[model samples]
Structures are given as structure tokens and as C-alpha cells.
Target: MNQRPDEDFEEDELELYEHHRILVDKGQSPVRIDKFLTEKVANATRNKVQQAIDSGTILVNGQPTKANYKIKASDEIKVLMEKPPRDTEVISENIPLDIVYEDPHLLIVNKPPGMVVHPAHGNWTGTLVNGLVYHFQHLPEMKGNVGRPGLVHRIDKDTSGLLVVAKTEEAMTPLAAQFFHHTIDRTYLALVWGEPEQDSGTIVGHVGRSAKDRKVMDVFPDGSQGKHAVTHWKVVRRLRYVTLVQCNLETGRTHQIRAHMRFLGHPLFNDAMYGGDKIRKGTQFAKYKAFVQNCFDLMPRQALHAMSLGFIHPVTKEKIYFEAPLPEDFSSVLDKWDNYVKHE
Candidate 1:
């Protein structure tokens, strides 16, 4: 019989969004690992089960193993990933999408700020998935396993940028493998609160959901909690108080860039979740505060954008790239900062 998934974990190096633990019944028959897990995990497919195995995300008795491993009596199994419940279905929405590129296998869309990528608890409608469903009949799921159709990766709701969607399993499988191997190039532009001491640097740390606030993420430099995340950043331009920086994600985790920037004490401007909404730099003059407040009013969301994406075509095997210009809010806010720095 299949057992319940247990999340009983210590401060281990692994940072799985959801951890499933299974105990093989003493009378259990020997069965292939991939086929075995397909029955055990809810809302999971054989393809995903195989992907998890190939990615070394599935463990038997605490050690990564191959899909061919046979289950036995008294064996312990664990699977790690963000899991969505089986019964949930993402409803379609009439929201318009900003499609940049499309072909038989895949498409790229420039997601605007304030739109959720997928349907979740508080956000059910008006999501990118909702819009995609309206256009594409059905798309392959991503690593999140939340019915995020054709999504290779995702940006935050408040952060606007480019995203690619896979239209076929032929495109989806390889794209997922690319993201897992970190071969997909993802570049972001962010307006940070303070200047970095170094012009270019990399932030390495483990990131997990904050203990105090479940709504946001936190950096655990000690590696005691969270998953290993790496971000490389270089200053694109310095606007005196704030810096326009380009960030390259080496590993994609929940809020990796935002949390890592916060760890460096240069949170993205107007990022309320990480405390960037408050003025963390510059003078404390009444005029300065008011100016910052005005800037805040102009761009209420975090000042981050997915600037570019580069990856090999999952089907054609050809190198493909796409980019998006800064949205009006981000560009306008930067203009204000430039004017302020010039007048200073």
C-alpha cells in the first residue's frame, strides 16, 4: 500500500519545496522505481517521475538512485519538488497576453507586472497560465508541478519580464532539463536601493521561505536552511543613490535574486516583501524623503525585470534568444532617479 508523504527533515542541505516520504510495505513486491513512484505520488505523471529521477531529485534510503532501481520490502523512498494537489484545475481567463514569439513547439511572452504567473491560493484568475490556456489547447507542465502550462520558468507577479512557454512535450522535456542543468541563460535588470562595493560580484547562498513571514523568502548563508542559489550581478549604471544592475541567475529558486540582493543589503527598490520600499540610502532631508516617496508612488511594485532569455530550442536544437525593453514604470522611475542625481 502507498503511504503518506512525510516532511520530517532536519536542517539538511536539500531544500525541496515539498518532500514526500514513503515506506515500502514489508510484503511489497519488487517494482521499478519510475513505475512505482507514478502510483505513489498524487497529481504526478510518468514523465515527471522520470525527470525527477534523471535530475537526482528522487532518493531511496537517502541516496539518489536511477529509475531502474527496484523497490523492495522495508525500503524507504523520498521525492522532492513543489507539488500541486491532484484535484485542482486551473480555469481559463479572458486576459490578453503579450506574445513575443511563437512556433509549432514553443512561444515567448513578455509578462507585465501585477499579473500572477499561475493560479494559486490567493490568485485564481488573471494569471499567465489562465491566458495561455485560452490560446493553447494544453501545454506541458513545468518543475513547479502546479499545472503551469508550458512554463519553463517564472518571474514574480510584481516583477515584469520575458518568459518562454512550451507547446509540446517535445519542447517541454528538454527545456526542463536545460533549466535543471542551469544551461538556460536568464538575465534580469533591477534597480537596487544602494550601490554595491564591487562593480561585479556573485551572491552564493541557500534560500528558503522566511520563518517569520511565510509570504517572503530569506537567505541562509550558513546553509543550515534553504536550497543553494547563485546570482551573478554587474552594475549597468549608477544613479547616485540607486543602481541599475544586470543580474544573471545561475540557479533558479523562489525569489533567489530578491533574497540574495537583500542579503547584500541592496534590496530591489520598492520591493515590499524584502523591505526595499523604505529609503535605505541617501540623505534624510525632508525634500529627499518626499522625492523618494514620489518615486515610490510612481512605481509601486519591485523594480525588477526579466530582461533577456537564451536557450537552445528544445525541438530544433538551435540556439534562440529573446529580450524585452524596460516597461514604462521601470524606465520612468529610472528617469526620475537620473534627474534627481543630476540636480544633486
Candidate 2:
């Protein structure tokens, strides 16, 4: 995937027309264009009208047009939304941050499960953004400049582990460069549905969206849209119906570890999206089926966590390694599986 360039926008001169992006509850048709702009553009003023038109802030049918342009059906409309001005009141709150390491240039945070790395739709507030906003003051702008302020790299919401956040633009550039070049070493611990035939192996292929379904990803032939993904796995322990594996990532595609494990006929235990029928069986096939069912029922997300992280520090220019112990949920499942195997 092509990396998005950092966009710098000063908010003093321009205002975001949030109303233009909002859904009309009634879905009414062809209201006056001027009136539409006035509602969407906050704190509309007389002078702002001319400014909107002249500066090409407002558009009619995707083309720059005057303010008085009337509305019509099937006309694609857009607005040049401005970013919010920087505020310095940002400070660390009692928002429960799992800080592993912190310094002037960067911080390594052990992001807990269910906490998103950054804000998205329906998850704007109470995200890692909310935490970072409260944690640091005057954080530098990032690539996708909206709610995500300091984030350099991201892990999935359910995937708990270490993530690097940049405090200054200098650090952000190098950290992002490291990820783009695939120099960052990331290791994950995952519980999969089946045991691999081999003790250790590597899975390499081009990852792209499945042609049959947009929601699914597959290892496709060359020239696909998705990038190449490589994962090396070693069996840590084997259960009757599942396997605990440590995975090292060579390329970080979306769901690379989980998808590759599934592709290798060993989907993560609680991964409903790719679990196949193996997940629905719960613990029924296990010696301690009840224990397995309890584990799966309580854990709503994927059973994957970033276990280790090692990379050259962007600011210090020295090697840095971080590790996170498996959370209780994962440990508990392993304990039960171990006991069951011992009895068998």
C-alpha cells in the first residue's frame, strides 16, 4: 500500500463544514444550497459567504461554484474541510495508560485489549487518541491528521501489545520509515484451532482481497492489490484440538498473522471471521470441553497478542527491545489445555 503523505492544514483561515458530511435524518431533497452551507458550516457569517465561494471551499457537482448555486438531485457535493486548530491544554489524565517506556521523543505503550490504536467512526472518543491527548502536550501532527495525533504505527484493537508513539515530527518520520522498510521486528503469540504438522515453518505469499468476497483476504497471484505478507511460526505447545504458536512477522499486512495461520489450516481459536466450523465446536472435542467453552465465551476478540517488539530507536539510534507477557485470558486457556494434556 502507498503510504499517505502528511497533510498540513492551518485551521485559522478555514472552517470545517461538518454539516455537509452529516446524514440528514429526514433525507429531504433539494433544499437551497446557501441554506445547506449555512447549516453545515458552523458559525456562518455574511463575510464567510463570499469567502466560501472565492476560496473554493464549497463545491457544486464536484466543481467550484458560487454560494448561491441552487441544489439539484444527483449532484455530487463536497466541501474543503479545515482541520481544527492546535490546542495546548492536552495533558495526561487518569485514563489508565500502560506505559512501558517514555522519553522526550517517543513512548512505548502496552495498549490493552479492546482499546483502538486511534479514533474511527463510532469510536472517536475514549480511544488511544483520548489517552494520548491527555498524556502529552503539543504532540506533533501525524499522517492521517484528524483525531490520531501522535500514532506512528498501529496494532488491531483486540491485539494487545507494544506500540511506538512519536512526540515530535523528527521521530515520526524515522519511525514510519522503519515500518515502510519492514525493519521493525514484531512477534505475536496466538492460539490457533489446529496444530501444524511441522514444528516450525514460514508462510510467504501475496496478500489481497479475495476475488469472490470483498470482506475476505487471500494469498493471491502476483500483481494483486494487497502487499506481500510473510510469517514464520513455531509451535510453542500442542493441544488435542488446538496449538499455541509464536509468530514472527516479516510483512505487516492487515490480519497477517491470523490470516496466514488460517491459510495454514490453523485459525486462531476465537477468530469467528476465519475460524471455520472448528470454533463453533467450542471445547466439546477437548478433554476439558467446559473449560474451553468458558474461555471462548468470555473472550470476545481474537486470541492474538503482540508478545515481543525489537527495533532501532528512531531518536536514540540504538537498538531497543520490548516484551509483554500474555494477558490472564490467554494464560488461563493455556493452563487448562496443559492440564488436560497432562491427564491424557
Candidate 3:
């Protein structure tokens, strides 16, 4: 079914913004960034470049710089703006989008749970990409199977959080570079089955598809196989049988947090893909079991959300950051736990 153009969308559970970046190549002579941008960027003028610099939207080698600053050869330049990029041929659905920020170059969105980032297999419709294809016109047509047409990165089908979309290649290139270099900052909030003995910790291991089950990933601590992954975590609050923790990713891998948490013996609450659907902690009493079952019924999926993101803007060269709050389902479940703990 098609969505109406005037249809309203749910309020974003979080905040987010867009980015575009660039890098000066070697063998280029020293030139003021304002004047230099005119020669390099399309439709950019000295006045616009100066305005971007003054607004602290441009960065030199990850640090904000002045418009008159001399950009040396090989220096990385980034730009953050609320602009949209060029267009593509994605199938436009009338899906409503929780647009956080947008310009001619890029767009930021707050994605809710139960929605896939891209289309594939049996889950082909009602994806975030379908919504974008509907909301934004003029996406550039490219050859081959363009999975995730304009996405910079992806969150899980059950994970709620922030994401950036590139409308043009100028925006995608630098953001992609930042991700490859492990420069983008991403943080997640997770509710796990047990509290950690330590207040803060780090998990370093390789993550790959499990031999027993190709659908889910497993963590290899011996470094013998899988892709390298690292997650740093700190306790937010302890709720008797469960703990809320914050996680920061050093290297993004499939199911890194869920797998690492399981390896640590604290799998995410109700994470059916792992072994968290059961009551891993708490009492074995019938009443306690009932309470946990209630919680499970309240929240059927893994309790995780992408809460924060930070990166260098591709065109403006300034540092840009985004944050999102918990959605209704997640927040309501937490409230139930909090009330239970206080009553007990």
C-alpha cells in the first residue's frame, strides 16, 4: 500500500544529522581553503565556502579550520551540512520517514524497530530504503544490484537508532572512508541478563558465522577465525536480575554486541537469536517466572538501541554528532522493571 504524502510519522525516539566529506590530494599547491573549494567542488563559490567555515562546518584533518587557512596537499577536508545529495532509481514507497536533518547532500533518520534497513529475500517490503525512495526524488541510477542504495551504514531489524543517508557520491565517499578507517563514533544501549562484576570492561575477539548455525554469529576469543571486533562497555544501572549498559564499538561486525555479551555470560535481555529469551538470571520461583514472562511479553525482541553517532562531515569538514532516545516499547519495559525493583 502507498503512504500519503501528508501522512504523519512517529516522533523520532532519537536525534541525528547528515554529513559530506572530502580530502585534498597530493601534488596540489598551497591555497586558501575558500579559494581551493571553488576549483574542486561543483556549484561551490568563495562566499558559500567562507560561510561554511565561519559556521564551523568545515574541518581540516578532523579539526575545524578557518576559510582563509592554507590547505596543504594530502590534507583531509570534511564538510557537515543539512543538504541532500544527487538522486537514484530506488523503488519509492509512500513510507513515512522520521527525518532528523536533510540538505541537498545527505539525510539523517531515526529508525524504529521491526523495520529492515534494506530489502532482501522474504523481507522485501516496508524497509527504510523503500521509505527513502518514496520521500526523496532524484536518486542517481547506478548499475548492478545496489543493496542499501544510499545508506552509509545499517542497524539490525530489531535495533532502533540513528543512521545517515547519502543523496550524492560526494557525501557517500568520505563517510565511507571514515567508517573504513574506524573513525566514526557509535554507541549502543543494551539491557542484559546479568550485571557485570566490573563497572567497565572491553571485549576483544573475532566474530563470524557460527558453524553450528549459519544464521547467527559467534565470537572467537582465540583470534583463530572470524573478523576482528572490539566492544567497550560500562554499566548504566543494575536492575537486580538485569543490567543496563552502554557499548561503544571500535570495530563494527555482524552481531558483535550480542555475541560478545553472550560470550561474557550476560546475553542481551530477550535476545532470541542468542540464548537470552529465557530467564538467565533471577529466582526459579513460579511468581518470579511469571514476572519475567510478563517482561518478555512486554518486549519480544532483543533490548538494544543505537543511541549515539559521530563523524567528520565530508564537505564542511567539521565534527558532527547525533543522539537518539529510547523508543516507547523499550522505555516502557524499563519502566516496568524499575517499578518491580522498587516494589520488591
Model number with the top lDDT: 1
The candidate maximizing TM-score is: 1
Report the lDDT tens digits of candidate 3 across residue range 1-344. Answer: 23221111111111112355667778888999999887778888989989987756677887678877998988998776532242323466888888887878888899988888766544467899888877876553222326456765677788888887888878876766676666889999999998899999999998866755545778998988777888999999999899999999887777889999999999999999899999998888898899988988888889999988898888888898889899888898899889989987
**Per-candidate local distance difference test:** 0.82, 0.69, 0.78
Off by over 4 Å in 2: 5-94, 211-215, 221-225, 276-289
- Winner by TM-score between candidate 3 and candidate 2: 3
Residue 125, candidate 2: Cα error in Å is 1.3
Over the stretch 190-215, how does candidate 1's per-residue lDDT look in tens digits? 99998898999999998877755544
Clashing pairs in 2: 91-134, 92-134
Candidate with better lDDT, 2 vs 3: 3
Clashes of 1: 0
Ranking by TM-score: 1, 3, 2
**Ten-residue segment with the worst summed lDDT in candidate 2?**
6-15
Q: On residues 254-329, what C-alpha lDDT tens digit does candidate 2 reach at each position?
A: 6777678877878788876666324533344554566666777666677888888788888789999999898777
Listed per model in order, the count of residue pairs whose N, CA or C atoms clash below 3 Å is 0, 2, 38
